[model samples]
Target: MIGVLIVLCSLHTGFAVTHTGKGCVTGSTGVRDLPEFVAVLMLDEETGAYFDSKTRELQIRLEWALNKVNDSQKYIHYFNVLISSAIPDLMNALQFAMSLYGHSGGIHTLQIMLGCEVSEDRKAGEFMKFGYDAEDFISLDISTLAWIAHSPQAGIICADWNNHIETAQFWKGILENECFALLKKLVEYDREILERKVPPEVSLLRRDPSSPVTCLATGFFPEGIVVSWQKDGEDLHEDVELLETLSNEDGTFQTRSRLTVSPADVKEHNYTCVVDHSSLEKNIIKPVTEEEIKTNQDPENSLPVGIIIAVVLAVLLVAIAAFAC
Candidate 1:
């Protein structure tokens, strides 16, 4: 089985840092036997960017203002370096951590989150954690690497490592001296752009444009948008499937809401797709028309019509042949 390594970074108006990297190794049988691990360098509510190791492609494009900054390139270069250097250690740590769990091969996840939150008062709180699935194996706070929390038995091993004083000290130093340093600089540099909010361009689409239509609301921003199908004035919940929100290349988001409707319902009912987002002062409503529905119906659904026509032709041919005979 192939492993996936994902790296993410985001900076928000409050200067919060959310940097996380995760790697998962799977067994040959497509089972996850090796531990999955996530390492974070920073947390926040802003749109984040993803870097695919295999493709080496950045999913989100940099804002124009960000592109104009000289340090932006330096920042991106540093991010690349951090991910490259940390991934190996994270993978090794995952393998070692998995071994300690007494399992050679199975699906397990290890996550590390490194974060810094600065209050309006200029006081900063830094946080870091190492966890397996939902269980926190170790946690630390502040620049001194003070032990704030840990798992019951896992705390023993964590404490031992802290006593040696390298791991915790390293993260504390990096978070305070390096990560926060960069965060402050980047936040100040991109303050205007970071504070600016761009509303998404909402588009309603049909999967088949016909009966049993799947409605898609795409190109929304800030990751907060409501998409639903409605009949008349009431909302629809039955036969509705809402897919997960997907991130666009521009850091906006897209989601799909599917509705199943019959031909009779299309003719009698007024169906609409309603979208609400922070960017919009009022909800955007797109009505579904009968013509649109009929125009978009699946071509496969016309198979019965074709079959009927063929049968009629065959019967006419048989009658003609009999008369001539």
Candidate 2:
């Protein structure tokens, strides 16, 4: 049997410390752009280490993560052992799942995701779920320690997992105790970097005279922020589109709020972009004037080519929408 493997890591929003691990296996080889097997470890949003089947060696990516542990070799060995054993199990499970669904002659992927989080108020959460072909298959309800099958194909696996009470307990123990402890320790080790705030560089942008005015704030840290529009010193809610905050490669964040109004209205009315962030002493107020608005059409006010490139790069770097609501 031929197969492939993939791993992904992500962080949760509003949590003081978050750790997530994911593994994926495919039933056939020759899958474009996928490795045979891979494993990655992350602390918050930063990758600490990674291992791939091709290299067959664990590589520490973060200096702090390496320094935090006394026995780096032992830590690496532990993950190597876990991943070495899991590869075959994941492949077999994927094959089994595919067979159960009567799937054949094409690549099929099975993914396992597990994570834990600790909030500022001492609240905690844990999750473990499986997906097939990018759709939910089964999940573990940590509250009840039961397996919930999302599809008919997952029923057998669910029943089998639910019967193994010890397995659930094992995960519960790690998530509640070991995982929490590790995350806290890591957070403490990197507290300065994680907690430090950076103010945003705000700008006003528009594509043309007829386009909606965009108020963009970039290079901010700690994520929590608000971008709003105002007209004549009062809040303007109508014809406004506030976009979700996006992550940047430098661990900062960027967001924008757009106001749709006619050129005539814009020229006649006083409009401004209000930005509120934890790092700022006071809110940033940027007036949307013709002279201040960057545009591609207007030669004198054309947006800087470098800034446009940065915006495109930021959009591409968005692996997932870190915040939802």
Candidate 3:
């Protein structure tokens, strides 16, 4: 019996190592390219980002399963591979990727790597909000895939939506639990900001005390909201700021927020922005400023509230659109 081990090469790519699956040790393709008979599970999410030890475990699980299917144990053979990070449309994403693998008619295996849990109303902007602000700490990507069950010649491993460490003991429990909590915070915070009648200034930026991240956050609330940065929850940027509180095309009331920090604050304080709004249940996240990010190298970006939701919704529609809708 040939043994096949499919390892996750990166966020959007996987490699198939076969020893017992067939007379193989044969298919060793480059990372960016692949042979015709192998199916690659590309994990695009973890590729550019740093996944701590816990999330890395999830990737490993997917790797183990990939090996099983390709081994001589009698899963499908002679299929190509499709690698991607976030599935734009679960079904469409799956189907489209599979077409490359030659299993488009009805794929035997469909896997998902879930990093965040979303409410029914998940959107692109909201989906990306956490990823945007999650400097090296925020959780916005998948931790692992689960193979719930299978048949004689086939099986399935996917993203477990109802992941629970219940008491602990969940698969890769540490990664799933913490990452889930962080993503939820983003949704809750956004909803609060949206509801505020007199929403205070809000800025979301990333400044690493270890090393600053130089990426400007995009503010697209459609509410004419201004955003900036702070340190120790204190406001930043006067000489080093871009204060732009403009009139909306419709001319409503949008509050101003700025993001700024000093070298001392960056080195010593845990500064964050605090926007006091009448509509929000509480203050939203303390955002970073341009200066804070300018000196930093691994600058974290914030995803405004509109885009992530759109991407997630699109992906949901593709996978089980009928069920999703």
Candidate 4:
């Protein structure tokens, strides 16, 4: 049987590795002169929200595997396994592990599960073909072939993220790619939710002084949703006031953003609290009830009748000149 590497994706919660500095033996590459097996594990940083009992079991299984491999000196003598954190990309983890071990050459495997609909394991056709043909590969999931066509290389194998390398492929060599992907997802999701008519029970609370609204909103998914206040359709400085949002029992969040805005400046100004959500995107414009009246105000919203006529005549003259030309 091929060597098995088990990867558990629950390390986003973080595991305390007892590094003895003596070097733990994982397994051998089975070579007489140089035998090294680089362990690479890919864990999603954003999946911290989905921790459950199943993931805990998987984590325990990984630790057991590591202990068993390290304890057995007869089959795999003097092999070393090191743990690396913050490796989100599959390929980058491979390169980094291989480099860290000072090995001349080795292949790093990854676990493949499409969190999205287009994950390589989604279909058996061009997507799978394109995914595998891209490189020397290993499929961590055994059930993938069940969904895909006949392929000899890619097979299901259980692996742990703590002490295992992955067979999955990522687009870049850095976790930043996934981070950016996540950011894009967040921004897009925010837009999507905020566009809804219900407005996601979200609202931006701006302060009159504009000192920066720093307050916690307690009431839905405090972390899942954004609570911010705005004026003139621009983001308020976060440093001016930081917000602490708290979630409610009903899974709603109430965010309080406290800011000290100049009451004189914004007394009757139309400042709006805009919320960009996944399903609701409506903004609640605060009523300018305090209404400011400038005694000597030069109206920018309207033009004098003589000025309008003069501007129209000038435009007409320009149009006629262009036509004549």
RMSD of each: 19.8, 9.4, 19.7, 24.9
Predicted candidate 3 versus true structure: per-residue lDDT over 264-285, tens digit per residue? 6555767554444334576566
| TM-score per candidate | 0.64, 0.69, 0.20, 0.27
**Best-fitting candidate, measured by TM-score?**
2
Cα lDDT tens digits, model 4, 30-98, are 334422322222212111111111121111112222343434443122211101111123334334334
Give each model's whole-structure lDDT: 0.48, 0.62, 0.29, 0.28
Candidate 4 lDDT score at position 170? 27
For candidate 2, list the clashing residue pairs, or say none: 5-36
**What ranges in model 4 sit over 4 Å off?**
1-199, 203-211, 214-260, 276-278, 287-325
Query: What local lDDT does model 1 show for residue 311?
Result: 10
Report the poorest 10 consecutive residues by lDDT, candidate 2: 304-313
Better of 2 and 3 by TM-score: 2
Give me the candidate number with maximum lDDT: 2
What lDDT does model 3 reach? Answer: 0.29
Q: lDDT tens digits, residues 1-325, model 1?
A: 1113222223233322322111111111114442232222212333223332344322223454345446665665655554444445445555666667775775655555445544442426665555564466666765566665465556656566556566557666765665455555545655554444456554444444344575555556456678888889898889888776665555455666777777578779988878887678888887777444333422221110000001111222221222122
- On the 0 to 100 scale, the lDDT of residue 183 in model 3 is 40
* Runs of candidate 3 exceeding 4 Å displacement: 1-230, 233-242, 246-264, 287-325
Clashes of each: 12, 1, 55, 57
